[model samples]
Structure formats: structure tokens, C-alpha cells
Target: MSGREPIVPLVRRFSPTLSPSDDESTDSEAVHPYLFGKNSSGWEVIEEKRRCVIIADAGAGKTHEMLARARYSAERGRYAFFIRIENIREAFASAFDVGDAESFEKWIGSEDDAWFFLDSVDEALLQDPLAFEEAMRAFAARIADARERAYIIISSRSYAWRARTDRQLLDQLLPYESPKANEIGEEEIEEAVQTGMSDPNKLTNSIDVVILDDLDEDDIRMFAAHLGASDIEEMMQEIKKAGLSSLSSRPYDLLGILTKWRSDRQLGGRLGYLKHSIAVQLDGINWTACSIDPSILPEAVGRIAASVILTGKAEIRVPGSANDERGFDPIEVLPDWPRENVVALLDCTLFTDAVYGVVRFRHRDIRELLAAEWFADQLANPERRAEIEAMLIREKYGERILTPRFRPMLPWLVLLDDRIRREVTAIRPEIAVEGGDVASLPVEERRSLFHSIVEQIAEGKDDRGARDNDAIARIAHADLSSDVAALVERHAENDDALFFLGRLVWQGQMTDCLPLLLDIARSRSRGLYARIAATRAVFTTGSKEQRDTLWDSLLEVPNKHA
Candidate 1:
């Protein structure tokens, strides 16, 4: 279960829309082409058409599906070229000497006998849309007649391929406001579409569009079984109870959950569970040679993640390399450790060596989570906090101190502490205006925003509110500043605010806020909602002595209903 399991989930395939006279079906049908040879016969029909567009969201197993297809084709005596679309040009250049269609056909031996799996076309388009489109058009033109000789399968995100009715696929593929589309007349547009340049639907009259369906109950159960869970039904119940149904359907998220469940049976908060799972992975790695303290490994990894986020580069060069001048050395963060040991520790888990000896996290989500955790840890150090704040503020004025990808880290950044939240809002005031950054507003506005946010959380008006609360819990666990403590005290009388504050204190394990919670728990003036929240917070967060006193006070109340 640690390494990727070979269990292929069910997949659904749909044929392009067609006229009734076309005698083609548009309904999606479940297929197990990767698992059973008999089902692959239908895949052969798709292969005969020699063109397919696989569409799915991020982490939806599009790459895995394409890889599985390639494996199946290989088993059937077909040579499968699994090429990442981002490197498609390089792959083509290296594989064939001639650029023309006839040369390409001759190079492959028999076009009809080869299967080409082009993965992540959307990534290529995202990096350089215009260049990708031009290259794709040229490639398509070269292989247009070779369709019978080769099968070409390309994968893209749904957003990248979903064009307006009035907009041709080429137009959508053009860079934002690029004049290339305007330069092309309708005739050229139609020609490009017909030639299958960017227009996946027009690849052929019988193109198959396979949209990956989310995992169902059976898939989840089967996957859980693969993870070696003792009771599949109970695991499914826990997944549903955690409101992780949508996440469970995704392969990566489901794997993360399974990883955590294998280590710890208790299903906690999503972030905590994911972090724990990552820790378990790291712990299981044989790092005795590194000689680094296990306790500080997460902090070191978090620092690396922060560097990746700020630099906007997934890969980090090894220490002492010419590209490592940006203070990316693990020794810079873990001063007590040997440089080689630090490198070994980094190579342990959660990261893999990339091209040129650089390293990158296993997943973007893991990087983001670790960056957030690192920022939270930084809040306790005034110098580090100030340094980060100055850097962020400088970037706000377009100095480009941080990468644009760093923006996703903001939600997690603000959750470190109220002071950190305030600093972040000052850097991006629009966040406050949008009701997302509440700590920097004027006292009255902050109060209003806090109440609104809490109400939204209570009513579940926005799915994002839960994420916000999760962030809030991260910072609340730390000791609160006096100013923030006072703000909480003012709202302690308001039942909604008080309940939210109690939950924050409980979730954060805020030792500084325990006295207020204790007061509320012992008081009669506060309503039932406030008192109940306070009682829970005290019992969950207070010291043993404080809890005993609170218990005695609760028993002393003559009317338990009151």
C-alpha cells in the first residue's frame, strides 16, 4: 500500500456526439480495458480510430489511465510511446530524423502498429500555449494520413478543452489576447479543426472522448481493501462521516487517506491526517545513515517547501550547485546537521530527485501544505516573521519578491496568527474587502466580518468557510497576542461569536484563552449556546485542575437545564 498499487479502477468512455443517422452512441459505458483483455477489444476499436481525448481534473488519474492504456497496447504486440506532451517535441525530434508525415510513418515501422500516449497536453498549453498549438498543428499535419498506421491519444484538463461554441479550439489554445487567432480567417480555423489541431472533437468522425468518472462506493471499497483495511464497510462509513466523499473519489486524495489510515486508524481532520500520513512515510524510510534528528525533519522539509513555493519552481538544485546560491542549502536551516546528512534526509521521503540532481516534492499539494506549516512555525520567531512580512509587502508592490504561485499559500499564511493575518491583509487589502482577510480591518469592521464568517460557518453557507476555520485553528493553537485576546473577550458575550471563539480555542489548544473559556463555563449570564461551547472548550483544553473545578461548578448548578 505504500508504493502505488496496480489496482485499476473502473473507467467510463463516451463517443462524440453524432446525428441519429450516424448510428453512433453518446451514452457513457463503464469499461475495464486495462484489467481484462476481452474488454480491451473495445479499446482496439478506439485504437483503430487512432485518436482519443482523455479529459479529467487534476489528481483524477488521467496519467495513470493513459499509462494503463499503454500497458494494454504493449501486451497486444503494439509498440506504445508514452510521451508527456510537455516534452513531445523533444521526444519526436529524438525518435525520428525526418519531420514530414511520410518520414514519421517510415520511422515508426508501421504507423498502424504503434500507439502514442501524449499525456498532460494541458500542461504544455499552460506553459506556452501559442508554441504548443503551433507544434501540435505541425505534428498533426505530419500524421493526418498516418492515422491508420498509429493511434494518437492526448490528455488535457476539462477547462483547457471546454471552448465556447463561437470559439474554435485553436482560438482557446492561443495565449490570452494573442493576435494569432485574429490573424486566422474562418477558413483557416475550419481547416485547423478538421485537421485535428487543438480540436480534439474533430480528430476524426469516430473520436472517443473518455472523461474519468469519480470513484463510486464499490471502487472505494475495493481500494480500501487494497490498502489492507480490516473492515471496508467501517472505513467507508468513516470516509463519509468526515465529509470526504468527493476527496475519496480522487486517486491521490484517496491514497493520502489510505496512507494515513494504515498508520493511524483514527480519522482526524483532513490536513492533520495528510500531514500525519506524510510523517509516517518519512519515518518508515531508512534514514539511519543521515544521522539527523527525526523530530526536526518535518521542519526542514517545510523550509524546503517554502523555498519551492517562493521560488515558484517545483525543483530545487542540490546544495553547493551553481543554482543553489539562493540559500537553499538544508544546512542553512538545520545548522547542526552535516551537509551530506541533510541532503540524505531530504532524499528520504516526500521528495524525489528530479533532472540535474534537483529535488521536488512528490505532489504540489504536499508542497503547499508543508509551506503553510513552515509559515505557521515561523510566526513564533519575531525576526523570521518580520522578514517574511517585509518580503510579502515588497512583492505586493510588484517587486516580484515571491512567485505568483505563492498566492495559494496566503490562505494558510494568514491562519498562523492574528498578527500574521493582519500583516498579510496589509499586504493585500483586497482580501479584507473580500471578507477573506478579517484580522486587518478596523475594529468595528473586523467584528462585523468575524460575525459574518462565523455565521457562514454555522449555516455552512460557503464550503470555503470550513477551510478558513481550519486555517484559523492552525494559528489559534499558538498563544494569542493581547490585542487579539481583547478582541475575543469583547465578542465573548455574543453567543455566535462566543461559540466560534470557544471552538477556535479548543481546536488551537490555546492555553492563553482557557481562562476566558473557564469564566464562560462558570457564568450564568451567558446563554446556553455560549455556555455549552465554553464547557466543551474547557474540558478539551484546560489543565486537569481547571477541568475538575469546572466539573464541580457544573454539578453545582441547581437547574441543569439552565
Candidate 2:
């Protein structure tokens, strides 16, 4: 037979009640008994209380192994804090919105005498660099100071780079062996056969425990069976184009070939478009093409868009009136633009929208695309490069949006700014104001301006849920802008605003607001609050339609109170 080594099969015992859905092994029923360290070397490692880091590339069974260990510890009555950092950050931030810092700290540090599994630290660290560093250091400090015993295990992509002890241990454990120099020829095999005949049991001790098995041609065919026809075609093309036909069959090489094909359309015609249009604008150039440094990417985008965002030109304008009369000045001709000496500025207002990621293109595609092309050429256009360089100033330092919380807000800002600039110019004649400067006016004056704008907007339109919240807040209560009452009109027949106002009324212990509530119940849709609130408010007002609408909204709330 062929001289392949045998694998030492270890018995893998598992909990009898485990199901496939519990693949992450979080549930007690899903714990595998065989995988527990008590039955294997894993037990010794954990018992030593030595810091351990398991290093593996993506899809290398890291999560499964980590989950098994966590479940094992938890089964023995130990608390386990399985913190998916991304989820924790989102949860903590939301909690902070309605609570305080102490509440957030308590939530994260809830579990006592626990084994903490901080999984996917790479994603956690990358998303919020500052928060990750602070949290990690703080956690280490907390665990150190804890009164009870707590085991902390952190899984991170950077473990290989940062865990010096683990690296050294792994290096020391590696076995180096080579075939004996004298056992090379056919005579040696004959001599070994005779020796084995004399001592048949000798073969047992000579076998290598871990052998690297080479994939034979038939094994490659079996792998091809795992891939669909399209993937096979793509793989073949990648191998041919990369000129790695001889080595492409290796599993790691095969994966890399697929990734490159997906990332770049260099070889495949059906590779598809990049998500953003700007990706097309920078065609054939590397993402790092400008060599400006990634540290400056966020700041560069921010500074370039800052003028557009604040000036009102960047806001989403209602159709037409794309001219400067609406404050849409093309910044290409503007003076004092830094980096002006390094590149030619395209002559168009850099209109941006939040599509296919944060897209920033000129409103007129033809003009913007032309500018994008010309600006790209500046790298090699020796003549204009210096001028472009002079146009953009080098700021001391800077950094990086979403949700009403903070995220998604940047896109809203871009959209709102554009809309405001355009509408202000169009409505300038209606209001005798100095330009479109809302901040320049006194607080009361601004409030007056907001009221006029809202009244003008609501004059003839059917009262739908669409109300200008900021305007309403400015008009009603400037100091309490974040409160819902600040956004509704003192008098409007919109059910949504009324329902929101109902809660405020409820809080104030006032029932005299029924007239306004009655007007809203008759004119618009209903059931924006809990059933009891809606029912109580409607019955108190004595309206048939309001009670019926309350019934409908009750159906919408799952598990609603009677």
C-alpha cells in the first residue's frame, strides 16, 4: 500500500440533547461532552489558569471551539458573559440614550463569578477604535480587582501578533523530523521488509502521528463536485489568468483566486459593478491610489463636504432651480480653496447624496464625471499638480455617522442642507430675512421664523403625518427640542401629533386637552400609543370613531394590555 500515515482518532462525546440550530453551543443542551477539556488536554490548559489564545484564520472553527469551552464552564454553575462586542456597543449606546453611564456600566458588568468570552474582537475593535482600547484596558483592570474568581478569554484576530507567550509555546511544540539518510534505495526497502518480518510489531512505534496529506488528482475532482458550474468556470479562468495553473489546486490558493476575482473584474466579465458610482470614477486605480494615507480619508471627505453641507447647497432641493439663485454655487471657481495648486477643480457644486454608501458627485453627471476624470489626472499632470496641492490646506489633525443617535444623521444633514438652501432662496421673498441665516437671528426671532415657515407649509395641504419637527420645536418650546411635544403644532388635526401630545398631557395630569385630541381623532388616522392610553383618551373624549380607531391600533400591538 501507499506509505500514508494514520490519524489518531479521538473520541468526540457530546450532549445527547443538542440540536443543529444550537451550533454555536450557547444552550446547555447543546454542550458536547467529548469536546470538554476534562476528557482531553484542554482541561489541563484551563486548570493551569494560564492565558490562552487560539490562533486560526477565518472559518477555521474558532467560534465552535470557543462556544464549547464557554458552555462547559457554564454547565458547572459558573456564570458566562458572552459579549458580542458589536451588539454590546449598540445596546449600551441605546441604554445610554434613556439612562445614565452607571446603568450602562452595570449592564456590561452584570454577570458575577463568570467566564467572559469576548468574541470577534477584530470587528469590535475596528468599528470603534477608541472605545475598543478603553473597554479592553478597563475590563482587564476590573477582572484583576474582582473579589471573586473570574476567568476572562478574549478572541481577537490580532492575538497572533500580540500574544507573545502563545506564539513561543506554539513554536516550541512544533515537531521537526526527516527520513533517515540511509533508507533511500530499493535495497533499503527490501531490508526493512525483512526486518519487519522478524519484528511485525515494530511498525507501531515507527508511524508519524501527524502527516500532511497531499491532495491527489481524484481528490481535486471531488472538490470540483462541491463547486457549482459557474464557480468552476470562474475558478478555471482565475487560474488561467493568474498563470498559477500548477499551484491553483491548493485549497488556500483556490480561495484567494476566488476573492481576487470577486474584488476585481480583471478576469471575469460577470463580476458585476462596484457598490458605489465613485468606484467607477476611480476605475483601474487602486483604492489606495492617491497615497494620501487612510488616516486622512475621513477628514478629507469631511472638509471637502463641510462647505457644501453648511452652505445649504448640499441639501436635497426640491426639483428644478438648480442655479446659483438657490445658493448652488459651483465651488470650482471659488478662491482660497486649498489643494487648488495640486489639482484642477471641477466647475460644479459637489452635490452629494447617501446612496450606495456616501456618494459625492456633481448634480449634473456629465459635468461631475468630467471633473472626476480631470481631477484624477492631476497625479500625472505635472503642470497642475503643484497648484492643486496649494489649494488644500494641511490641517493639524481630525477624524470621523448614523441613526438619530449619531449615525444616519450625516446623510440627513447632507439631504437637509440641500433642501434648506434651495427652499430658503425660493421662499426668501415671502419672509423679509437677511439671506438664509437661521443662526444669526435671536432665539425668539428664529422661533418666529420657524412658525411662519410651518404655517406656510400647512396652509393648504391635507394634514398627513408629515410635520416639520424642528420647525415645530422652534415655535413651541425652543429649550426642549428633543421632546415630542416640541415638534407638534399647538393646533393641528394630525392623529400622530395628537397621540404624541396625549402622552405629554398624560404626564402633566391634565384632561382639558380633549378638544385638540378630539379634532385629531376626527381628521386623521389613529392608535399611535398603547391600547389603554388610546382607549382611555378616546372614551374620555366620547368619540365613536376614536374608540374604533383605538381598537384597530390595539390589534397592531402584539400582547397589548386590556
Candidate 3:
């Protein structure tokens, strides 16, 4: 089962404790991923809640788990069906022998205890966003109008919960305050789901949201052992030694690591892993089997990826279509390449999935990474950079690069364009947190970019002084530990800065911040909250020796302060 069985993984039901002000969100709050939990996974939740929305990062394996759930239902002799968003109309029309999506919508929820796993809403949005949203709301309405009898599960790449109204529409009990890293545990998982069915008046109306956690150590090793990787222990040790423990924790990234395990290589950062994986995948091709050169695949795929960025479309439908907004023949982008050969190669590649002749990168993250690399190469030219900036900002043309879908690619864009510095600081400072880690980048430039954002944080306290533990923990990527540690040291006197630092330490992979936390915890001059925050972090992540030192400091605290 890959240790991914549906179970009651830790979940944060909307807290009943939200204050009135929690309903209002600022700009930054509008784009954040919600809390992720580990426990029993999507399978159990689907069985328990008649309607559930599973959200996760791209490549966190939502599609795979959904299929598994469908199988589980079938073995039990329950009716179950899986649907992808791209071919929603075609698939439904084919299944029910109907004419179009509208007719199919009318036909769904026709069977009681029937489970419909609607997958890949994010990819659908990338193509036809308005249509996708309407389809979901419509399908949900169909489920609702059916006397609330049909079972349903939906999954999406993490999209920001845009408004309080949106939260209410989903029937979230209360707005979540951007979760903290250490605030969750199985014991506190919101009473294992309270859904619309429990309330007689609200049956099937509430769609409870759950995010699948990344592969924990046991899950990672299970997959490794399942794959029969030689020297699994050595492989795990090597990954940890490379400071890639964070990346390896992700199911998608872990599979890449395990599949390409070699005692000799350093997987490097995310970009490095991509490069290595690309080379390895290219190796899987037998050049003698065809006229196409191995290098051609990357060139073609890279161009296709860049096209996706400019168009905000993930699919390149074969032969094109008059009605498909996302459709484009591959040859249209690469006028020189043979359409059949390129599509064949792409379909064979591990990194892509071809559904009913419509091809998409296996995950949006892959698409974003490839596009980033391609754009970085082009942005090297000053004139091209100017053209791109104009187009991205114009909002009417090539592709709106400023959209949230493009955020993953912005760090790569920033690497080549100096003019984007303001946007980096003001719009998406998390760019610095993510980009600081690439093995190939210049550390000084990234550090400079990060500190400017930190200064912005120094501006003032958050309205409620609530910690966005998820956002803060994201900064604790192992590669960024030193950069974060330096920033913490620089802002030891700034309570806000210290507060952010404390969060990173306990809730994040902040191995480098222990000494600094100890120093602050032992300092009598710091605020009680700051000292307490630092003390918690020290005790949480410190070594036995470090804990002994912290214990000694604690003993002296009353007398020393007195």
C-alpha cells in the first residue's frame, strides 16, 4: 500500500475559536497553502465524509491515492468512478453514453453510495479556469440536489483560500489561521471530521478539506524497499548527508531520489535533482532505436514548457482543436520537429502523462521548473527580458506571468532579471526562501534578496500577532538554514524577527539556529515571550549536550535575572 492507506491522518478542522477579525485576509494571506496533516490518508477520509476536498502540492501523489481509493471501493462491491478534469466532458459522455458535459452532469449521482473522485482541478484551471470552477460547483450542486446520497471526493493542488466567503462556501467550520509547524498532532485532529451528514439539515452540503502530508521517514523507506533499491540504508544516509532530507521527504522527490540512487552522486538542490533526473530519463532512451537525438527531447520539452508559462496552459492537445483553449500541436511550437516523434517521446517519458492524446507534465511543479529553466536562458538577453516584462505585465497577451500559477517560476526569472527586485521584495518574498537553495545559484545575491524582505517584516507586527507556521516552516529548507540562521542573528534584537526565527526553529528544519536560540533563551534582557519562544525551540531540536546547556541556563535564569 506504500504506507499510504486511507486513515485519520492529522487534520485541522476549522477551529471554532476564530475571532471576528480572522475573517478578513490581507493580500499575502490570499495565496498561502493550507495546513497539511499525516495520519490515515485520503482513503479513510473519503470513506468517512460523503464529500471531501483533498488539497496538496503538485506531485504529492493525489492522483495515485485517488485511484487507490477507487480500487478499494470496487473490491468492497461499491460503485466508484474516477474522472480527470481535462477530458471531463468526453469522459463523462463516453461513460454514460451522453452527448456533452451538461448532460453528463445531469446523469451523475444517479447511484447511491457511488464514489466519484474528481481529480486535477488545478491543471483544469490552468487551461479553462472559469469552466473548471463552474463544472466543480455544478457537479457539487448535482451531488447536493440528489438527496445527498452520492459519495464524492475532490482533489486540487493547493490553491489559496481566497476569501472568508469562499471558506464558508466550502463549509469550513471556521477560518484557519495559516497553521504553525508544531501545532498539530493526531490527538488534536478536530474530532476526526464533523461533516454535513452529522447535521440533519446540512447533508452532503459541507465539503471538508484535507491535505495529504509528504512521505514521512517510514513512508519513504517503504517505497524504497518496495522498489528494491540496493543498499536502502546507505541511500537514506546519503540523502540525509546531502542536506536533501527535506526534498527526500516528498513522495515525488523521494521517488526521484530512490529511482536514481547512486553511491557516487550528490542530488544537489531541486534544480540539480531536475537536471540529474532529466539526464537519467534521457538515458532510458535507446538512441539507436530512432533518428531523433537525445538532446532534442530536452530542447523540445523545454520549449513546450516555456509555452505553457506564456499561455498558462498545461496541455498540448494533439492535432489542435477549435474549442480547446489549451490545445496546440507540438509542431506549432517547434516548427522543425516531426509532431509524431516528439509526442511519442514525451508520452514515454516518466515526467509526462498523456491522457486521451492530451499531454501534460506529470505534475505542475515539473512544468513550472522546466519553464523556469527555459525562461532563465532567454532572459539572459536584455532585449528579450524587456519584451517578456512588457508582455507579462500587459495582461492581454503572451501570458500573464504575474498570476499565482507562475509564482514557482518567478525565482528563476528573478535569477536573470535585476528589474524584478521590487516584486521579489514586496510581492513574493517567499521567492527568496525557495530560490536561496538551488545548488547552482550565487549565495550572496540570494542573501541580499532575503534580507530586504526581512526588513519589510521588521516594519511592524501582524494584526493579530498570529504566526503563519506553514509559511515560516517553508523557509527552513535545509539549504536555506544558514541563510535563515544569519538573518536570525542579524535580527536578534527585533522581536518580530526573533518570533519568525523561533517558528522556523521548532516547526521547520532549523538545525543551524539552535545556538542562537540558546543565546536568546538565556538572555535576561529579551522579552518573556521571546525568551520563552527561544527556549521552546532549543528544547525541541537541540542535542542532549545542548539541552544540558539549556537546562543549566534555565536553572540560572531566576537568580541571574533577579
Which candidate ranks first by lDDT, i.e. highest? 3
Question: Which lDDT values do the candidates have, in the order given?
Answer: 0.56, 0.34, 0.57
TM-score of 2: 0.25
Q: For residues 1-562, could you state the per-residue lDDT of candidate 2 as single tens digits?
A: 1111111121222111111121232211111111111222333344223233333322223443455556665576666555543334334332111223453355347654555555545434334534444555444444444423444454544211222322333223321222444544656456557543343332222211111122333444444444422455555666455434423333433333344544564442111211132233223223321333434332333334333332323222222222222222333333343433112212112332221112223322222223323333442467975563333212233410011111111212212233322333233212212111233335654445444544443353212111211112112332323332343445354443353344434333234554445445443244333222334445554457655765575456454454
Worst lDDT 10-window in candidate 2 = 399-408
Task: Tell me which of candidates 1 and 2 scores higher on lDDT.
Answer: 1
lDDT of 1 by residue, 198-303 (tens): 8433424334455556676887777778657776677778876654555677777788777766667656645666677677767866655656567877877888
**Runs in model 1 with CA error above 4 Å?**
1-51, 88-110, 121-150, 157-210, 310-360, 375-403, 407-562
> Whose TM-score is higher: candidate 1's or candidate 2's?
1
State the TM-score for model 1. 0.53
TM-score each candidate.
0.53, 0.25, 0.71
| Model 3 worst lDDT run, 10 consecutive residues | 11-20
Q: Comparing 2 and 3 by TM-score, which wins?
A: 3
Tell me how many clashing residue pairs each candidate has.
4, 32, 6
Off by over 4 Å in 2: 1-50, 55-80, 84-115, 120-133, 141-151, 158-160, 163-562
- Highest TM-score: give the candidate number: 3
